[model samples]
Target: MQLLILMVVLLALTTFGFRLGRGRAIAASGNNPRLLHSLPRYHGYYVALWSGLPALFLIAAWLMLEPSLLHSAVMSALPADLQGLSEERLALVYNEVRNVARYGHVPSTDAVGQAAAGYIGVRDTVFLSVAALALALAVAGLAFARKRIEVELRARNRVESVVKVFLVLASLAAIFTTIGIVLSLLFESLRFFQAVSIFEFLFGTQWSPQMAIRSDQVGSSGAFGAIPLFTGTLLISGIAMLVAVPLGLLSAIYMSEYAAPKFRSVVKPLLEILAGIPTVVYGFFAALTVAPFFREIGASMGLSVASESALAAGMVMGIMIIPFVSSLSDDVITAVPNSLREGSYGLGATKSETIKQVVLPAALPGIVGGVLLAVSRAIGETMIVVMAAGLAANLTANPLEAVTTVTTQIVTLLVGDQEFDSPKTLAAFALGLVLFTVTLALNVVALSIVNKYREKYD
Candidate 1:
């Protein structure tokens, strides 16, 4: 409520300052407006920016730094008995303190709460001091600018420069965040590589990650071979592509070319409904419905099939991805120039011939892009594989038996209790880095192909 009041006051002051600044400019230039430089609105905007930006920036900076500083102070104030606690234990204590301070309810009677109140007092004092300073700076800036708001001042140009810098800073922040994430992943993957050879991890068969928990333990061999996981991911993705590409492309073609307006209005939305279905629901369908059906069919054919086979999960994933491929391809195909289709028809080509030879070729790049996106989706899928595909990593070409994927293993390896430093848990980060790289490469290639085709048409 206090924050809201402060914001409202700031907005009112800025708006009033803007109007006042513009009025003063107009007055100085006399009733003859032709004598004024720039426009009245620009002057108003300049005053408004001056009234709000500096104070807002200070508030934002204070908010970001306050929690960390407060938490550190609280940790330092902990009693000597709590000093020997592990980092995780200390974190738990801090969390309890925060809950008590925020809601006046402690989850436990820990000593952390006492220390937290002290920290909270300090935080409150610091925040009040910062807010006062910000208010004073804003007042000083407004007063100084108002006094300097002569007809000759270049306020418009100055304000425009400030706005441009603000926008550039916002863009740079996003780019820096992405760079930070990629660098963190790279460093962790490098650490995993130090523990396991890249050649073995990439190409070796067998993927039992269970290893000795302690150096003194005997009979421990940690196999880091990821071929099985890769194979399973490929099998699932291939199956999804097989199902998604044909169905999605055909649907896209019909919608874009042949379907009547009424039919499209109904069917397009119906297809989109598939995309909205939660993957967890798809997981259950793969487990309870698809898996059982595959098992029954295999039994009738006298072929061995695991109850939780890759085929069932892959098929469901295919079904899930159909809408993604179809929606994107449909838009791309529809966007192809009508002139090309007309030329094909003028050349005595039939509808199917024109579609197959002319329109499809023109839209092939986008179709490839959509298919690549679907493939990436399949590779990263977790719930369906976790529920329907077995946990045992089987490095084989046959999709009928049980298999596991990179995503599935990552979930299994990190679920429940975990030690971040252990190889078993750290392997997840390595797998994630590999997955990220693979998907990124696929997107780049797909986009490049799309751009090349677009250039030819353009």
Candidate 2:
């Protein structure tokens, strides 16, 4: 809490110092307006950047490195016999240490608890010392920079350059985070591929993931074929798109082209409420309502349907995505130039015809973008499938049968007690990589289509 408060105080002080520096620079230049380089706000921004950025960078770097350093030190202090433990076992020990340090009570041996408490004390002392030093340096630097503000400082241009650098850093952070995730997934998937052949995982129909814990265990060589999971995911996604696209597009068309202002104002918000509905709630709705309904309907039609069917989950997911597609499509449709509609109307086209022929084509790119966004949402959906799509990985395309998706398998694989290094558990990472690749490819294709459509208009 003290650290948080210190950070907040630092931010406020930095902002105040920047404003003061800018004001001072502006006042000093009042006698010679032509000598000023840039706006007063820019000058202020420059000072704030210098005051906060370096200290923040130092703090971030220290925080990241400190944890690993502390962990390594604690591990080294452990008995020599314990030091030879596997990485997973070491992680368990670390977790116990963390718990003991946090609660001041050991769930295990008293000696271990004492060791944890000692480690925690040392870690906290070191962290606080470093933080204090950093804070003091930041304060001294801020004061020095504030004293340097003057008419000839070119503070505004300097500030603008700093702002640009900050923006670029922010973007780089996001890109780096994405790259990190991909690399982690790739390495884990590579581990999984070593255990199970890529061809078998990609094309084989069976997906029994119960592997041997011991060398003597029977039926331990579990097949890692991923065909069924992929099929189930595709089936569910297809069903969801079928339910979402037409309804969302029609709603968007009505709202953009025909609805009165009063009706649209009321309806648009109501439509968006679907997006606000918690996905867990949608999950239960799929499990309790849609699944049972489908089963009953299938019975009436003399066809077999599992109690937990893909159709139920997919349909609910589609309903959840409708607002996403409709709202985005409506915005793009409304943005279409008025001249196109007018020309169509002059050619004896009705309102519906003008919208269908002129507005929709003009807005096709953005609408495709919206639909692709919805597709990504569908692919990544978890809760609805977990509840309504049963854990049977059926390779068949029949949506009525019980089938499992990649997300469902990943959840099941990681949910309970498991060994992360085992083929069974690491399979989740491989599935995740495949899922990521598929979604990325879909996005690329969708964006390409949207860009081409946009180019036509341009």
Candidate 3:
């Protein structure tokens, strides 16, 4: 709340700085705007940028350091014995102090009360000091910028340079974050591979991660084969593609080629509305509605059907992915040049023939790209598979049987209170690495195909 109040105060001050700068520029120009190099608004923006940027940078740095500095100060003041607590115990103590400081709750004991009181005092003092310093810096910046607002001043160029630097920093931050995550996963997966062989993890038919909680507890017979996991993922994704590709393509064709403008506008949004529905809701519908429907149909035909089957999950997943294929395909198909169709018509080709020879071919790359995207979505899906397909890593190709995919297994292995040093937890990282690699490969292949066909179209 204090931070919010400080931000609001700084915002008002920045607005005042903008008005001050604009008024100064106008006064310096003797009310002749042409005398100024840049527009009056640019001078105002220059002051606003200068006034806000440095103060925002200071506040950001203060917020980052304030917690750790306060934590250390509070801990140093603790009793010698209390200060000797383990790192985990110290963390708990810090949480208590923070909770008390934020909520002003009465501590259960005198010791805790003293710590919380100390934390509150230090936090309030720091907040006020930092807030004062930030405002003073902003005011100084405002004055400097206002004084520089002259006929030859290039305020807009300076502002743009600052913006470009910020954008580059933001991009670098995102890239470094991704690199950090991938490196962490790679390192953990290497640890897992030390316990279990890469060959076993990749080609083994069984995946029993729970059987080994400790390094010494692992048995040679403990199934770590990831064949079933890979197979299950492929089966479900293949089934999803079977359902999605045809239906989505047909819908796209009808919407783009056959439907009138009014009908297309109304129905397109309605179809795409399915994409907006949450995956959890789809999971619930699949488990309660789709699974039972499939079982009943199988029973009537004297066939055995698992209560939780991949077929239900894949079908539901396909339905979820339909919009991706339909929407992108529609856009690409609509983008097919009218001259191609006209030439086909001039060559005595029928409407369907022109569509088949010219339109579909022209849009084929985009259609393939969209289907590849849908395939990725189907492969990464967790909730629908978890709810509709059981967690059994059965190595059968039968969609009627219960099976689990790599993503579901990753979730299962990482869910409970397991030690990170154990093979079971490490297996999650291994599975994640494989999933990442496979997704990367798929993206490469998709991009390659898209590029190849794009050249022809271009």
Cα TM-score per model: 0.85, 0.86, 0.95
Off by over 4 Å in 2: 31-35, 68-101, 106-128, 212-220, 300-303
Cα error, residue 444 of model 3, in Å, equals 3.1
Query: Which digits, one per residue and each the tens of the lDDT, describe model 2 over residues 351-378?
Result: 9888878898789888988899789889
lDDT of 1: 0.85
lDDT of 3 at 267: 97
What TM-score quantifies how close candidate 1 is to the native fold?
A: 0.85
In the range 176-228, model 1's lDDT, one tens digit per residue, is 99899899888878888888888988897889888976766441668889999
Model 3 quality (TM-score)? 0.95
Q: Assess the local accuracy of residue 88 in candidate 1 as a C-alpha lDDT between 0 and 100.
A: 96
Clashing pairs in 3: 204-225
The lDDT leader among the candidates is 3
What residue pairs are clashing in model 1?
none
Q: What is the TM-score ranking, best to worst?
A: 3, 2, 1
Per-residue accuracy of model 3 over 1-458 as CA lDDT, tens digit each: 88998899889989998999888888888999889888888889899998998999999999899989899879987777778899999888878877887898767667778888898889889989999999999999999998888877887787778889999999999999989989999999999999899999998877877664566764433668899999999998898889888999999999998999999999999999989999999999989999999999999999899989889888899898889889989988988889999999999999889889989988888788778878888888888887777888899999999989999998888886888887878998999999888887777777787777668766
* Model 1 alpha-carbon drift over 4 Å, by segment: 1-41, 68-99, 106-117, 144-160, 213-219, 300-304
Better of 1 and 3 by TM-score: 3
lDDT for every model? Answer: 0.85, 0.85, 0.88
Q: What is the C-alpha RMSD of each candidate to the true structure, in Å?
A: 3.7, 3.6, 2.2
List the candidates ranked by lDDT, beginning with the highest. 3, 2, 1
